[model samples]
Target: MSGIIGKKIGMTSIYGADGRNVACTVIEAGPCVVTQVKNEATDGYKAIQLSYDERKDKNTPKALKGHFAKAKTTPKKKVVEFRDFREEFEGQVKIGDKIMVGEVFKEAEFLDAIGTSKGKGFQGVVKRHGFAGVGEATHGQHNRLRAPGSIGACSFPSRVFKGIRMAGRTGGDRVKVINLQIMKIMPEKNLIVVSGSVPGAKNSYVILEK
Candidate 1:
């Protein structure tokens, strides 16, 4: 599952062949540098680490400076590793090699995008868990439209059951959206447009797997 680390360049809409406006998320994929090529004998596993986005050298730590020095590349803002890389690229690439979006995903028909979802802070059950908050306002219930009703289990349990969907923190999680159709690929711009909304905010880094 070899992939590239990219930035989410927001979303856009393009007209389809059927004369309908199709929504898509534009991602600036690759132009990434291979920082590390791991092997089973040396690291106990196989993986390819890619570095993307430029960062100031002064902000980078001493240990990271040495790591990037081995790759002979400048400081990067983001680095992601793909485990059990695709067979096509196995033994073909090495550290310091530049991998473009078009090279690895040229024939890819679909993609899996991994990113951090937008944080929604604290939310109620209705918005967070799709709970149908107390029905009609009848039965002498006043101003309880968005209430979570009763959570107790009478005398048997007395205490509210755990794992019950309730009001709490929401979003800001690692989300993997699978089977996103590849709508377009702008190789020159190093961008890949995938159908549907991608996780994370604009300019956030994402991992594109095919």
Candidate 2:
């Protein structure tokens, strides 16, 4: 897959060809810099690494600063690698070459948006795992409404089994939303709008793969 790194820019609604108002996630996608081009002979795999978003030199790690320097580009806030990259460009892309949103979306009709989902801290079973709580509170069911009902059987292998869906942490995960339709592209603004929602909060980095 070949892709570009982008920043989520909230969402908006727009009319489609069918005269329907379609909800879309707006993303500021690229002018991503090609920071590294890995080959099997070197890194044991073939990949294209792209860097996006500006970052202060002082805030960037020393090693990453050197890495960006090797690419002849400024320090970037996010870096992502795409393996088995599609031949989307006219020719080989070298370090420091910019992959603009318009150029990347020219050959893509749909994209897989990969991003970190908004973190919902520790939550209960009802909210985290969608468990149906004990209803009505009738028949002395107080304080057990949202509680995880049981652990395990009394005497047979009597420990709580793994992955029973008991609640702990929620969200703040790497999520990929596949096959989002290309709703609109404002190349002049280097922005892309895709149908439906994308993972992560506003200003978060998202990788759009084709």
Q: Candidate 1 — what's its lDDT? A: 0.91
Candidate 1 residue 158 Cα shift, in angstroms, is: 1.9
User: Can you write out model 1's per-residue Cα lDDT over 10-53, one digit (the tens) per residue?
Assistant: 99998766788989999999899999999999999999999999
Q: Give the best candidate by lDDT.
A: 1
Stretches of candidate 1 exceeding 4 Å from the true structure: none
Report the error of model 2 at residue 86, Å. Answer: 2.0
**What TM-score would each prediction reach against the true structure?**
0.94, 0.94
Which pairs, if any, clash in model 1?
Answer: none
Lowest summed lDDT over 10 consecutive residues: which window, candidate 1? Answer: 102-111
What is candidate 2's lDDT per residue for 1-210, written digit by digit as tens? 788999999999988889999999999999899999988889998899999999998898999999999999999989899897877552488999998888878533899999999999999999998888767688998888888787689888878788788889899999999999988888889999999999999999999998
TM-score (C-alpha, index-matched) for candidate 1:
0.94
